[model samples]
Target: MGKKDKKKEKDVGKEIVKDKKKKSKVVKSEDGIPIITAASAIILIGIAIYGYTVYQDLAQVPEMPELDLNVWWGQNTTEPQDTSIRPYRIVFSDAMESEIRWLFEMYRRPNKKKSFEDTAWNYGVHSEAFAQFFSYWIFKYSFIQRPKFLNKFDHFKTNIQGLDIHYIHVKPNVDANTKVLPLLLLHGWPGSVREFYEAIPLLTTKREGYDFVFEVIVPSLPGFVFSEAPARRGLSPHQMAIIMRNLMHRIGHKQYYVQGGDFGHAVGSNIATIFPNDVLGFHTNLPVNFSKLAYLTWVFGSVWPTFVAGEHVDKLYPFADKVKFLLEEFGYMHLQSTKPDTVGIALQDSPAGLAAYVLDKFMIFTDPANKNDPEGGVQKYFTYDKLLDNIMLHWISGSIATSMRLYKECIADAEVEQVFSQIPTPVPTWGLRFKHELAHSPDFVLKWKYPNLVGTTNVDFGGHFAAFERPEEFSSDVFKAVKAFLSFKK
Candidate 1:
């Protein structure tokens, strides 16, 4: 009876094992390879579609146009080449002076309560400070003397792209045989060729140790001062670079060095990007753009401060504080970028308003601490006469509104990021970081964006207006950069 029961149990187990094997085979045949193949095919198709879409977008972007040197003010002039660099002068008319006086006397000041907090500038120019500046503009400042002061530099104008470009072309007081290097100096917004007044002497003067002397050319950017505004819209920094390059070429400088700050930084960078062959070297007081590698390195640098920041660890790390400061300061940029016409109209009509607007930058950008003072500490660094002269250039020329339009045109352009990203500046570059710069960028970050960055100089003094604040230091740095470039080329 036991033997028969054991035999039956063994046969039942064998039957159960066979049934399990048959079910496993059916499951693999039905779903395994086909399901995997379908998922893999779907992923491949998605990748291919994304790749094609990006390729299409990149293909549609327009390339920058070549500059037309022959088209002078859109008229075919058979005039000789010698007359191209015509002598120019600034003449402040009686009508302009009368209007400026009336506007200053009739200005209606806004009611602003004094704040014990350091955020007074958060509300814009201090009313009392603006009042004082307006008083100097109306009564004390001499408009007649401005032209004489400006004429001290060799002023000239050349028609380029249907607009008259005004620039101060000063050569070193040397013999014809002397090899003087051409250096283009570009000024930023709320500033004119006046900014380089102090730096000009320093650059042109032949110092003992410095091997090269500069033939300084400081141009009032298009839509600033005497330079005519763009007839059409969309004159971005890149377009301005084209005009500037053409101006250099017309001046008989095939290859030249460039130095700039603020908006000038953008223009100079674009010049180096688009026409690297023409730019011998580029230097800037303010350098923009932070690559992905910079961000990652910044994070790691936060942990090991000495590796990336060195002595400037405080300036580079604690990112939250820097971001907070930028949020407070970037309000003007927002207004100018979106609807410049709103404030531009106010600035155009009222001389007092224009003075307040431009002088506010002079006060704060010179040193943020100046915001706390009653007169904005403007007189601490800059003379009232000098500041008023700069304003007169804008007022007499009626270029304030058009000059502000650059922010609108460049920022609103859809291809701004694409154009900036695609262009890599292979030319040698140097950066100067002043203590109170709008944003203090470390050397590591500069190297990330500028592949051929030769050096970076950090100074304790000066802010956004480094060239104006410390001309000696600025000129010395320029000399260093030029020397470095010459060395690198060898």
Candidate 2:
């Protein structure tokens, strides 16, 4: 019996040895050549894809034209008085050119921390890029007309709500058959009328079988970009609404649709509320929820123990996640709201810093679902090139400090609860809520009064900067909403 047991143990040992050899062989085979080869192939493929995208981008970027453009600086309207009723030709003076050159240099300088270097933060980075692009026409070549059209944009000064306001008006080529909607586009802070360059094609042109066209009017917000800064304190949102209404009247847009995002959203909402009869309807990509804060308070207070115990999962539905997002993302707003000039002056001087500041928000907020990140976390939602384009506008215009003050002023007068609860808009409204638009989720939005909401397009594509990132999708949604308005009328 002992001899038989010894033989059995030996047989078991042999089996174990055979199994180990098999496992070893399999591991060796996977690691030896195939895995390394596959990884190398993947890297090569990624490089190829990146190269192609870069090529495509380079190919598409339009060139700057040499049309003797002007940079008129200082107090009031400075332009060559139009004898031919043509565009007022303005050229940058030597001093102005030097200032711009300095601006670009400040942006490109190396960061305090090498690892923390932000591409967008670089000064003059945007201006240099755009100016370079503008200087040489790419194959697509239509945008060279921008500088040419610059002179055509009529600049005017008017005092509205005790603040001197400035604006640009571009009338459509009126003809016997030309029928266009009067469209008023407002710019948010850290941006100007320049942000609409990409979207202008869709905004103001005649599409085939689409009889609809637009007499596009883009404006610099009060105390932002080229618009006159407020002389006094307490420039209420409601007061701004009055100013916008008057501006529209001045531009001959008696009844027009209003579109806005960010601070533009507040302005548009206010316009709709103040002058419902004049403003036809309102549309916004950045849908705000007045009820979100109230709902969050209620939910948190009700489930105090669950929240305290770190088991509050239900609130993640919309309201809670929004709060978390606000905490995580809005540090810039907090600082700017309190001390605009502080950050503004620093960013104004450091183009790189401004680029980083603006670019980070555009990247994170636009598409929290980072398609570029292989690890499946939000690295950046926007393309670097597009991000650069927006920042360039700020840099070229030299309006970084002026832009930040909009936030500082708005926040000081911000009675969120009062504004949200008190205002009731009768104008037809539509909201295109992107996936990552925090408090703008459907569940959360439904908690508020969407009295004027004609349609809500819950887009599967894009994030905060939907207009730029997913232009086709964004345009389609915009047209659809407009159709909804028309459909109801018919």
Candidate 3:
């Protein structure tokens, strides 16, 4: 038991302590295996459920409303109806002029009209803009010649669904050997057949390299302009689609292409969705997909936007910012969708108030930046006479109230939309995405809804009113779309 024996004893104790610690670490590692395996199994099961949900949604084909071609919208018809296609004319009758004169006179009165200091359209139509518009309407708007210009395009009316359906039907002035295709052009709120007036000639006439031209038919939606209003309560968007289809059938067209914007987009989309075989192609300026997959893909895009959107990523991403802007912009939609009759009474009564209400929307929609323009830059895209032509049409016909009701009809039944949301049509589609458009869905996202999406044209200008704002570009896109649609595999 000397110094060497003592040193060896200390070394042996240290080894024994280290071995116990190693055994304890091995036991702890073994205990965690089941927890790790259970966690992985849970994650795998969740992933499988998510995949199935997405697949089930993708495979869904929505059940559309069963509508009747014989369903009449007119009220209490006691006699045999005249279904003849008759020529129609727009007249600025003395009686209508007399009614308009007094309304403009009241708008001329100097009153306590004011807006907050330095605030622009953020508060609504700028005060100065409100005055400037009416001044032009009273002094410059030609109620006389504007009607002639609007009538230059041949208009006709025929009884359909017991209502006198008014439409502008134009034939292509091309060679007889060239093909003539039927095109159903549509309009939305605050817009009429007049919106397509500038684009109609372009579409109907010849284009380079294309052998076919569109025999364009633009309709003043039922309850708007010269078209007869529905007598009953059920003229929803789906019903509007039915009316439009019947109009085409009455015009001797079995199938046709469709191009629309705003609520026109809704009706046109419905037509394609319900009768895929009847519509040759669907073209829209405000293209959006309501399918559940579109929503899921959009949320997925937020995390990795490059995967969902490419150059237009900014338009789709920072989702919260877009949500905020939509909530801000949709106040009008909420009002019109819920109680259009309330405000419709005012718009139907006052030409000036109606101009202000619609022009404010035009200003912001043409370019969101115009919301900051104290003078309101609507004149940049349209003429004073042309602007009043649209405003006066609503006023003269007293269709403001009826036209506004369309918004309510469109959103009234959530079930109709819930069913529509699942439909993915085989109809070929095209999207004209403008730079300042309120929202944009890239090609990948659009494919889920429009599987036959042939193309998307990203214009470097304009906003909501494409045909009115940039007719040349809009018409060009329509031509391109029709060409692709014809050649595309069904």
Candidate 4:
């Protein structure tokens, strides 16, 4: 009876094993590869790819390019260069005055295509509002006193690396106890030394609590209004940083603080990254970090903004919305980065055309919300004569083409990332975030590029051109930042 039962149990176990094998066969891939094995292989490959991309942001940095310290950019490089600083005057000759009248006459003519009804700066510097200002610049604005205003600053030119570098040097009138620190104030495109005219007085003045006063040097960057343009290619921001370093050295400054915005931010970042030893401190209103880790952190923090946004969640979260808003303002950036010469011609040909092109930037960069108003609050923030003064300088120089060449240089060479975008600078850094600044970079992300970030000063007003628009507030912010920078150093 036991032998019969054992034989029946063995037959049942064999039937159960055959059924399990049939189900396993159904789970296998078409090529007979196990499903789990195939899934594991794909997952491993993805992890490898992810590591390759993120490693550089975390630790890997590209080698810095070997730049030519004495590279010649001028056409007459063969001749012995004049390195002596010389006094320069911004003149309005009779011939130039006649040209201004001619441009004025040309600009006064009614446009065949009128502005779309009810659209403000949304359609790019409302043609209606712009025309009225253009008329004021021509007839009512005082060109008689404008030159005097621009010339009020101490303007000088010195040849550096075969190019004429124009700058305004203003020293503080202070007591012996006060420390006068050299501060390099760099301005970006659509800006000239004129941008610093208002800030010069305030920056040079002594603050009560601080023992230091800034001896400001505002340079018209090469290819800008008074500075000579390079004759050849390859003058990216890094190269510009070299020129700035040399310029400061030439001015007897071994180490100085740097402050910038826009393309100035790009060049200043490079200076801080490559010439960290020479930069005592750095500051920027448009604080941005372009490293891969910074982007990854930003995206990762999207799920939980408290990780990256800190207290300024509204300004940075909903990454797609921020990106979309940026895209709307970046049309000019794309054009200048790709084909600077083409837009340069459009800007250089007609004074009115240049006004329309750059003033629109003034509208948006000053405050994105400016586009909502008919007048754009441009007049509210800046007086008519001063605004016209800036436009006139651009017109007089016809530098729109060459000044914009920096954009083309930076993108084409891709030198920015190799030099600083992926690299963090140890220089004591401070960020001033204006409520209306074009871009917002919270201190959390900024720390990736600026590991020694001393502090971030957040203001309720102002935008990109902080120094130009709100000199007092901008100066106060600068004072507080420099104090923090000194504290960090100590």
TM-scores for every candidate against the unseen true structure: 0.81, 0.65, 0.86, 0.90
User: Which one wins by TM-score: 3 or 4?
Assistant: 4
Q: Candidate 1: list runs displaced more than 4 Å.
A: 1-83, 108-122, 175-178, 290-308
Prediction 4 TM-score vs. true: 0.90
Which one is best on TM-score? 4
What C-alpha lDDT, on a 0 to 100 scale, does residue 209 get in candidate 2?
A: 56
**Descending-TM-score candidate ranking:** 4, 3, 1, 2
Q: Cα miss at 135, model 2 (Å)? A: 17
**Candidate 4 residue lDDT tens string, 209-240:** 98999999988889988798999998988889
- Residues 1-490, model 1: lDDT tens digits: 6999999999999999999987755553254555556767899999999988866544333455454534443334466544377899888888877777777656645554654455555567776666677666767787777778878988999877767889999989976655689999999988888888989999998887766789999999988999988777777787788889989988899999999898898889888878889999999998655333445566676677777777876666676676666687667878888888888888889887788788888888778777767667778888888788888888889888888988888776636634553445688999988887775556656654567888888878888887887889999999999989988861
Task: Indicate the residue-level lDDT of 155 in model 3.
Answer: 92
Indicate the worst ten consecutive residues by lDDT in candidate 4. Answer: 415-424
Tens-digit lDDT track for model 3 on 327-438? 8777998998889889999888887889888887777888878878787786888887767788878877888888988878777765676577577789999999998887
Candidate 1 Cα deviation (angstroms), residue 266: 0.8
| lDDT, candidates in the order shown | 0.79, 0.58, 0.84, 0.84
| Candidate 1: worst-modelled 10 consecutive residues by lDDT | 68-77
Show where candidate 3 strays beyond 4 Å.
1-59
